[model samples]
Target: ATAEKFRSISPAEFFYRNKEIAGFANPARALYQAVRELVENALDATDAHGILPNIEVSIERDSVKQYVYRISVKDNGIGIPEKYIPEAFGKVLFSSKYVLRQTRGLFGLGAKMVILYGQMTVGEPAEIISAAINSRRIYSYRIMIDVRENKPIIVSKGVWPNNTGWHGTMVKVAIEGDWSRAKQKILDYIKRTAIVTPYANIVFKTPDGEIYTYLRVTETIPPPPRETKPHPHGVDLELIKTMISETKAQRLIDFISEEFQGVGNVIAERFLTKYGFDPSKDPKTLSKEELELLVKALKEFNEFRKPRADHLSPIGAELIKIGLNSILKPEFVDAVTRKPVVYEGHSIIVEVGIAYGGSIQPSEEVVLLRYANKIPLLYDEKSDVAWKVVSENIDWSYYGIVFPAPLAILVHICGTKIPYKGVGKESIAEVPVIEKEIEEGVRQVARSLKLYLARKQKEEEMMRKAVT
Candidate 1:
């Protein structure tokens, strides 16, 4: 390999050449991750509009192709608009998720990567059916990616009037997959997603003629996360430059106050005076060096209020308990939602739930179910910070928890930015603040379980005394 071999490739082409980074490594994992990405997109669509989600997913072997499976997911949520549908599904890194919000998908490349995989493996175009909310027309397209150009090649397009007044999105793709290797994980992902989102009705059909349904237990869903400006902390110089270039505000003082969260005009004025910058100077006039210095000052000023964490929505504690009860059917269940905490200027909330006894079959250790932004983490358990907290920071004996008992613990972290270890988004890195919050939340719910167990023990002893 030499410098002469280097050539610039489009993002789509790069990911197509190296699909494993997007979780499309092998036949087994590819099938599993395809379902995960599609379902995550489905939920995000519904959650954005507070729509009661009704989703249907199915995977089956394609009739003529060996080891090729057809994957289809349909959701009754707000549909993709007509104009952006091509790029949204066909191009790489083109998505609505590149904003400040609590969403299941952080990287915008996942779904399109799945589409790219399908195109390369099976030589098939993606089938899309969508009816956006704004118009009374529905759209259908058979499209594929021109990876070298990062553009969508529309094989065919169809549009018709919406007679049923339905609005949602459905995407179908056929790809080479091994359904047997990851069957259990596929099922577990769906079930855990249902547990976390009690308001979503999920019906999943496996390739082996099995059907599982998770109906909506509650009609309520969490309010959509507000789209606020970025916090001043942990911001880089490039983003500041972009904000300055795009901002409509004329004065530097107004730019600073308007662009960042919690930095009012008064603070901006004081910050400008302290930093020896002209407050009335045009924001767009700042040089790269000056912008760098401004960012440093913002981080060190220490007078900015905490990021507005209330704008982020967490799966409430009541819904947590209800979802766990409905799924685990345990004898005792409790959940705790901790107050919001900031990590690298991103607001995060950790919610923990514990289910003990009854139908929960335990093993040598606690069964840890981890989630981030409501998407279940099915792989990489031990490396996750949630696992680290449960195994090391928490003392199970102190909470009356014993081995070989019916027990399960749930840890969910909702935030504007999830500290994922990789593009897989399967595990969280151990930030001190996040780990502490998880440990504290777990202990709170563990205390409730311990009290319940202690009372149960006392009742058993009293019954024995009466018998004597």
Candidate 2:
């Protein structure tokens, strides 16, 4: 009875009172994810302004013995309104659908966990200063918690005292953790981010006063992905139960028939008929056995099709240009957008691009291997079977892909579903269907690279002959 009673309380409430319940076995991991959340926010602010975004990041170490580190990200983009400040900073598990496209933060829970983690480990706070436009007014606040009770505590609130009307948001975080490991992670994140978001100008200042800046080379931003409306093709029993429980209508059949229209009714009717349910009968009159049968039927009918256009995101060609240009310092960087490659007999659609020229060494390839869902698949080439097609099948000798040379390649893959190896979130598990297509895609990329290399070789040979 005690165990049953203890389980009765809500999980959210339990975790709310115990912030540490989220777990921070490695503060660096948490901090890495936290910085990702902030950088994404800065990008979103830029997109909102209809202008190319510029961001500056700085890291400083303080209180040497304690190793307190301050990391700040400043963006010249569209700043948030005063009304959204509380909800954006305080709340957890909030979904914003103001824009319909699929994004990394649909739950709006990305950075709040950061704030909670900071309050737990650092004993300091996260600070934010911002203004919506060119106005001299700036709203600043520090986010903390009432640690004794695990409640939110506002540490500071004010406008910028300098009176120099800055027009963007600056977020400063002070963390009491190991800065060395965190520094490497931040650098890697910026490098990867540059490859993906080539259009944005990025500047990073490290704790040692070293700076790395990537300036935008192009004005184009990829087109926004299409929005997804609720589809009725699939609804498992658990999902159906939640939907029915939250629905305004009392009768189960009534809610299924009325609340869900079009394909939803058809699916519901099919599910009910399969399980010997009577569509004409009111769901409230059903017995426990009948309800159980309904749930089983619904469970069997849960296959869904995600909208395709909703999968695409605007990846500026400039991002590729800037990344390869900086890393390889190539004399020329050329990026080609391939139409969706249809591999024979496979349902998977592979879209790929590559940059080659100047001093691109074999080790310099920064392949942004993403699944169809746009989640990062951060696996090394050796583990991923896909690399086999690129390394073995392609002509590497001419491309300078010798023992330890650097190569710069960015590959993005998308489809209805991307099968991953495991929860470790490493490589894509090989499926016969997708593998064949990916092989073909790699062949095409290899052919392009080979042709470009051939041209360069011929030109160099001709020049040498002329000099002789």
Candidate 3:
């Protein structure tokens, strides 16, 4: 059997073999995911820099091969530095989003996967043009991924004269896709994205010469989330050790106070006393057994205050109203922004909105629009935690909602660490605390819907009496 050829593959090689896990299972899904990943990256870049986003996406079929399509995304955001552009687009698992903040792209694999899919299917390098914000110089690169080695293979790199004074990034890739089959899904994703991120301006040119634009309703960008220290309950043994190694605090007590939230001089000293450890001992000098004991103490300690919410940037109730109003056009609309809650020591906030009557048509089932960190979750609605909470936990009939009722439910979860079910990030994982918050948020809005329906019923009764 050829001497049992077996060797460990690089991250790129593994993903190349199992592209389905990264949301490129088929041509149709691949096409949709590519657009989503790129658009999300664009949004993140702009949001991080506090700039209003202008994004343009275009898809065109190959002249010779109808199945092959050229996909291009342009964004007016903070562009990648010239040197980092190749690796940023070409290397797998390379990312700058490794901080504790609410961002759309968490794993750092989305855009790279798009490049890999394009290269695997059409054997074409990605074309990139970028200019840093406030810079007049522009840089362009033609780069492809070396899947076996997980590195960027640059085909060409050069500078271009900037005439329009634009500062942002533009990415182009050629890949095999069935746009005809993926058209509706692609459009729906973009529209839902616009609904969630009303501050963004998006324009799409489809393969069939269709132009769709979602204009920005407001220039006000939501406040960017601030990075925060890890919470005591959120850290594990491995993370504890890593923090101990990297922290600059000389004493164990100081390290705890400086590295973790909810830890101060008093709390840190108390923890040391309870654990029978020297508060003055150098944290780096702790032995393996001592570190293990510290981890245990952290897990068992209940006196620690819940994680803070400064790291979370939830979509405000007013913005949710504006977004729903622009799209759903419902007769009655109500929104709730839940207070921040802690789960596994990480602070999370959930926002819920309800729109009833008017343009919203009643359906056989509830329409739940789920979002995580302001990015719309388009697929796997049936398996999401929010879906389960709405369908299984909430009794809609008590809230004056019935089958085919003209209603829509919206839920958004923002956190330092969202519990996503898998790499695809399509559904939120069912955590008890998260479920409780979601339930409470929905109920808050459901109560408003109930009142509206009750008023409508009373009005109808009065009309009947008047006619008699």
Candidate 4:
């Protein structure tokens, strides 16, 4: 047992030591993160299934410990199966979000991180009650994560008779938190989420005995995103090698067509022939050099169609407008949903909404509401690609957005894979394609704002003339 140590740390253990990576840097952020993780998880579950979301969140201050609070979130969504209840909520990276589809969770460690944080701070297991869709019986369990082992240790289990015939999931945990510091962020997160998710009816009860309820403003819910095959352009040498090994097709031509989207038999054969590759050759038999050469050729060949955006589900323009007007009661509002485009093989769609005047408070600088995959990113605004486009690229006066005004711009970027600057998921990388799309989206709504401002000025001038 010398100072030097060698070990294989599991994913859960890595998170245990590096809790800050999940935005639990302090008591304040940890508390906000707990609420965020739970709320986002609820949104993912319900939205994926096209179920209108009914979410409830409560944080109560513990009398025994001023800084410790009981945090709970209950949602009407598809519940986890009985067997997966423990690991799904206790393990760090054991969930269904790691695929070629859109979901609110940035990483597989959703509610599990909350459970781990609670376990470390309050030494309490998370209490979970769940009933899967179409199931009759309800299951209840108290589970804790063994961070070192990277698994769940179930403390207790029971069954609740389903006499009422309702189904969903409820999670409760007691954790140390700085409520005074985290309250504003938590409230803003909820409000922003409501603005984007207009179909969800959310009721939030604060520790201060205040209740903020956001009622559902629209019945429209975007269709569920479809799981898609990877595109050829989205891969590199290692991915090609892995695909070659896993592919059932023995021939290189068949393998290419079968494994990758937008690649067909004719295109695969043409690519193979152009690269001087044997179409009949087994891809698995290719050496490292051959594979590298093949990947180089794949990139060079330009006939492959762009990746289909079927896997991306974006909140439509109408829904975004409804959500913004309902929440902000803005005097003017306009929203635009951009068609999806490929970026690094992932589908990226940008939606921008602008709300002006009315109930919105005037600000010295432009208020930016940024979202990635339906999750509100309240921190690190300057680092996000959207902010860069708005702050640096656009001329605000041209769009009639001379600030010290009640103006807020909302940017929502939906992608199969988001280029986040950090693991915190607070900021997006300034990828060229993302920047272009964001700029275009903002301009689309900004023009509408300019028109509204022009009309308002005309009306004000007319009123002045009549008064004189």
- Candidate 3, residues 232-300, lDDT tens digits: the string is 998888999888888899988899889999988998888889889999999898888988888889988
Give the Cα error of residue 341 in candidate 4, in Å: 2.4
Model 4 per-residue lDDT tens digits across residues 265-372:
999888899889999998889988998898888777889878888778998899989999999999999999998887877778999999999999999878899999
CA-lDDT, candidates in order: 0.91, 0.58, 0.89, 0.89
Measured against the true structure, the TM-scores of the candidates, in listed sequence, are 0.98, 0.69, 0.96, 0.96
Error of 1 at 460 (Å): 1.5
Per-residue lDDT of candidate 2, residues 1-468 (tens digit): 355444343322444455443323365655555566677677766753455779998877775645666778899876767556645665555435343344434445555666666665676778888787665577888876443343445777886543765567888877655656667766776776666666779998887889998877667666645543333433445555556566666555556655542335566666566667767775556666765666565434553222234334635345555556765576445454444432221123454445554575445434333433333444344656566556554566655445444444555554333455642234676566555655665556556766777788899999999999
> In model 3, where is the ten-residue run with the lowest total lDDT?
310-319
- TM-score of candidate 2 to 2 decimals: 0.69
When summed lDDT is taken over every stretch of 10 residues in candidate 1, the lowest stretch is: 1-10
Q: Give the TM-score of candidate 4.
A: 0.96
State the RMSD for candidate 2.
6.3
Higher-ranked by TM-score: 1 or 4: 1
> How much is 389 displaced in model 1, in angstroms?
1.0
